[model samples]
Target chain A: MRTYLDCYPCFLNQALRAARIATDDEAKIKRVLDEVGMMLKEIPLDSTPPESGRLIYRKISEITENIDPYRKIKKESTEKALSLYPYLKSRVVASNDRLLMAIRIAIAGNVIDFGANWGFDWDTEVADTLEKEFALFDYDKFREKLDTAQKIVYLGDNAGECVFDKILIEEMKKPVVYVVRGAPIINDATRADAVQAGIDKVATIVSSGTDAPGTILDTCSTEFKALFHNSDFIISKGQGNYEALSHTSASRLIFFLLKVKCRVLARNIGVEEGGIVIQAGRDR
Target chain B: MRTYLDCYPCFLNQALRAARIATDDEAKIKRVLDEVGMMLKEIPLDSTPPESGRLIYRKISEITENIDPYRKIKKESTEKALSLYPYLKSRVVASNDRLLMAIRIAIAGNVIDFGANWGFDWDTEVADTLEKEFALFDYDKFREKLDTAQKIVYLGDNAGECVFDKILIEEMKKPVVYVVRGAPIINDATRADAVQAGIDKVATIVSSGTDAPGTILDTCSTEFKALFHNSDFIISKGQGNYEALSHTSASRLIFFLLKVKCRVLARNIGVEEGGIVIQAGRDR
Candidate 1:
């Protein structure tokens, strides 16, 4: 989706958050804000928010001289989510509809995101996601695609969310290629984060070759692009990837599984903020 | 009173809000954000937020070419508050501690502020403020100072809030020099707004000379500075005045009557966010 006017303030807020995580020195933090503020002047409104997010994170890293600012947070999130893995798996196993339960569990994990600026109440979020009705539940299409698909491409979002994604990937019962960012950006999963979440055990983890929090096809590695294009069944995860791929009209059926986080994204997707969506295919 | 790191993002948010109020053009709104972002680079940490707030609003005016963006909202707020005046006055009159009730009403009015970024629920806020316990209630000190004080300098806050202040001024039964902004800034009360709220009938309305949201002393008119300095009793209303004057080492007994609005101000005053404070004098 194209960047909205509301995204401008959010961009600065996210920048400030990353800066604080990267450094304790107030001077350095101020410098990061100043640089990022100036950077906003050049950002185009037509580009997806994640495209600009890439630059903001890069600037933060440069100013604070602390690469991978969310590294500690990512590790903590992974460990915490790993502890809940068994419980999550049990819910999926005990459910009448295992696939739907796993999908809910994955969307519930989307709350762990740091970039969304929403508070996380892990227990409540899990319960609520399991009980709450989806804004768009394209379950029949999802089941049909999964039934016929041989190779599934699963797009990974954040670190902790990878464990949740693992549950869904297992439920898919097919050969899956899990995609992660090439490098660190916010708490977005890299190869290491996915490995920590045991995603590597369930599926092959591939880098999208862009350190961006989302999958911008133009910036993706040739191999990952090939895999994305070749697969007829794709499960796009979280706001970032959804933003980058939401409007793409590639010859594939993509299912977006996420908890709507912001007003702009919610408006674009025709969902209420904090609502879940199991959407099928590209939206014009 | 110094600008907190947290205030930087808030500054941009406020600028965007003011910009949206000023114009419907998306490009103009973007320009406002871009300009405000660039302006943050020069804002010093030691300066009061209102000092930078002055610049942000000025930039909005320059870019949008709408000097008084909140004029219509200010008028609407005045009309809304005026309608509540009779009921509010009746509550004060029925209370045994009329002054204290009046003070609560004034603080309740503080919630009408547009700059705080908090949602408004007029009926609920009035009822809650009347019923809630004050975080810092210096009632005895407030009464003691007001008892012997000859002249009072009451720093006016937002436009609609002036009507609430009028009730308190009536209870004061002393000559009140109601201070207002020299020019339009945010929803801050100016001479015209105060008059619209019938403040002219109750108190002597005067301009502070500074168009900043708060009473920034250095930028005030010589007349206002004299009035502020000479008065032994001063009633400073809302977060803006508290932020600007919280640390001022003036030779006067100032009572800060405000509903705690933001985290930074809440920390500075040792009050929790969303709580009421009737604090007397400055803190080191």
Candidate 2:
């Protein structure tokens, strides 16, 4: 779960990417990238990369003077995903294993994220994740846990991915609390993004009350923390949640549905970069 | 020739690769990568990436306290090329165009550099460069020049590559002054490395004075510079020499015989990365 040396350059790259997305101001981008260089030594090698990621993005946002710089991009991303909803739904419904199909669809949608991936091929990713064998699939265990679970807390990742999460939640048919960020942090889905994605139509939408880009439990509100602790099971989506929560509260039956994007996170999950994973609980 | 933003991560990656090759010490590798991170901002975006590259490798040498860390590896690399010499020479002899064949062989040999590349497969590269279409081939112009030229000043790149260069020199049938480094810097061919590769038997051997890992004319000895100036034609090999000399003295009948490697150099040559190039001159 600790950050690797390789993550250092990536930190800068992510900052550069965020700056590019935030504005077309050449001067602003240069200033942000320069700040990233200045802050390199401050990165904690022992902490998770997402923790470092949050810090970098925070600095980027501070310099740009826009807390939600990805605001328009998030809305545009949600609209893009919504455009795919009907086609994706039909694919899941036609599949023999609807749950499995929906899970892959949701994970595939994780690629819609703006904060991590700069851009991704939509059609190829959808077909591959749905049809191809996963690098880490614990579907049997996940199904077993879901069968007995009373309540599910789904930790959402990005704007566009929230729409995919709704499709998966519909498949689960459980009492679900789809968690969104209380404030904007990178491109992580805020309650606004979730609403834009129509996630409220499928489950009770709640804010995590932290804008750390991931569920850093210490930074979350008491209400969300209590709800998280009370939940019988959790479905965590994307690398941000995986990085932040993989080491802490790992024994609490959190199934990580994510694509291994970065080297450090991939190593932590014991999969190759670009590997599709459906891991059953971090402790398991 | 200026460093692109893309080159920053590559610089760190190169430093890490060198650190990994230098010693198995994990801490040393981490230290070197950290040093590279520190040096990132100091890089002049308005200058060539190799200028930044030299600063990075120089730091690695300082931190590891070992100049020419690739010494043993260079020897082994030369031996690997030497083993293929006879087979390659026969291929050249059997070919319809001996000059063009020799040119490809020499360009293929450029991949043997330890400073620019980590490891390259000799057989595949040699086969492909010989069989495939070059991204840039000014062979017609080069042949016209070579028909009248009496002397060639050959700039050598790496140790193992010098062996391949020898095979090309045999095919050229012209008087050649082989230039190697005065001192060790990466796996670049030094006087000792060139001597070991039997370059002395094939051509007149000399050294550029400085160990900057490139043909910086100002840093080169007066004798070598004079020889370079006096030569009727120049056969410049590898990316290092290309970076240093490509812009300044490009019109002085220099035939760049090298593979396009690295993003910056590839961009400089106006070709795709991994391109096999035999450019007539920078301006041409």
Candidate 3:
């Protein structure tokens, strides 16, 4: 997504904060500030409220100054995710159909997002509305199928969300395989993070290899294909997974996620803004 | 600026590359490689060629992902500054004199700093450097003192460079007061930078306000007699300016810039690992 003008100041703030934390020499600090100012001028800004952008900028600044800005935020975000388990479990149990139950479980497993990402709390009012809407379905037949399946594969998004996924897998007590994008940018979870979170111990972690959001099925490794062949259900999270895998003939694939930023996704699922969707593949 | 083992993959390579170019989708690029398998469980072989940290991590990825990361790079890099000049001139002229000679005058009319704060340029590198380096210099005895006095300022640095100082200023061509840190940091030019650069337009740019590198000089305003009394040299650049003036200073300041990673800077400045610095003052 193009950066809004609102984001420009935030970038400056981040750079300034980094300078504060990184240096003590006055001349050096001056030099860094000069560079930061130039950067701000060079980048174009999207039209946005200065207030919102400023807040984000300040937060980024604080993070740079404090060092490891992502870690603390990730920790807090994960706690929020964990806190939502009760609501998620209650909603899933209250669902009318097995499909709804499966969808809820999959969502509660955690959202794997791609592109135009925003950090949102899973327990917010918007999220609650989404859960309620998706819970009104039946997925019992799918659940029966899943019970006999030997393996399940999950694609993840962002970093903190990965922790929540690990929690979901442990609760389900099903053998799970985790997949992620590889070697592209900071902020996304990595194989090291999985190991750090101990997800590696329970699940086979794999790399998609490509940087594009859409899943290129042909790019799947032999191991990934083998797991897919044996699994009865494949739970894909976020829009990227859907965009990539929607054309597949696998009837067992279920997509669970929130309608955060994409118009195309909202149209495809026939939902309005902030909608929660659970889409199952048609029998081929 | 010794890099930590954990920061090498993303920080040195991915993030640097992103910062150098403009891209359309930074977040998408950020999310593309978030898998467990792609991460280096053991540090990659040290034989991997060393790369420019900023170029590797911040530039390439930002451009490839379609994010315009160079708004600041283009604005503050030395290359961009050189283009500001109408003709070929000295980029970083140095001298001990209070006023630059004829050769300096030819190129001194417009200084294009690679990484100064805001967008102000120098008329002469030598005079500008002297004004900044020796704020207390007895300019009356110098033959070029009268000729050096003008309404231009040069700003430089990246990340924490002071861009906002210019924002607060109502006018550009006045007795501008340029501010610097009264200390030194790694790889930062001294007050000599302003003088040698022949920055005669500035009335005074002092390091009195900031004691440490990147420390925000909240009191830098017309109200503060010591830092901004009859001050025409209201140009500050780099991380030092940002650290000292982004919040408390109300005076109009122009900043120049370039984005250089801290670790790399430390190496260039030949300082101990993780050192911080500021510019120098008469007291020092």
State the fraction of real interface contacts model 1 keeps.
0.61
Ranking of predictions according to DockQ: 1, 2, 3
* Winner by lDDT between candidate 3 and candidate 1: 1
Q: Give the TM-scores of the predictions, in the order they appear.
A: 0.97, 0.91, 0.35
Task: List, for all models, the DockQ compared with the true complex.
Answer: 0.80, 0.37, 0.02
Q: Could you tell me the lDDT of residue B135 within candidate 3?
A: 17
> What lDDT score belongs to each candidate, Candidate 1 first?
0.90, 0.82, 0.41
In angstroms, the error of model 1 at A49 is 0.8
**For model 1, how does the per-residue alpha-carbon lDDT over B1-284 read when each residue is reduced to its tens digit?**
89988898999888888898899999999999888889889998999988899888999999999999989999999999999999999999999999999999999999998886556888998889999999998899889988998888899999999999999999989988999999999999999999999999988898999989999899899988888887889989998898888888862368899999899888877879989989887545
TM-score of chain A of each: 0.97, 0.95, 0.58
Candidate 2 CAPRI grade: acceptable
Clashing pairs in 2: B78-B160
Better of 1 and 3 by DockQ: 1
Estimate, for each residue in B1-284, the C-alpha lDDT of model 2 and write its tens digit: 55666666667667877877777776777788777777777776676655666678888888887777888988898888888988989988899998888888888888886665666787787787777789887889899998898888899988889998998899889888899988777788998889888899999998977577678787788988888777779988988887777777554568888888776677777888889988887553
Worst 10 residues of 3 chain B by lDDT: B275-284
Q: Candidate 3: misplaced stretches above 4 Å?
A: A1-76, A83-102, A108-114, A119-121, A125-131, A135-141, A163-173, A184-188, A193-204, A209-211, A248-260, A282-284, B1-284
Error of 3 at A142 (Å): 2.7
Please tell me which predicted candidate would have the highest DockQ against the true structure: 1
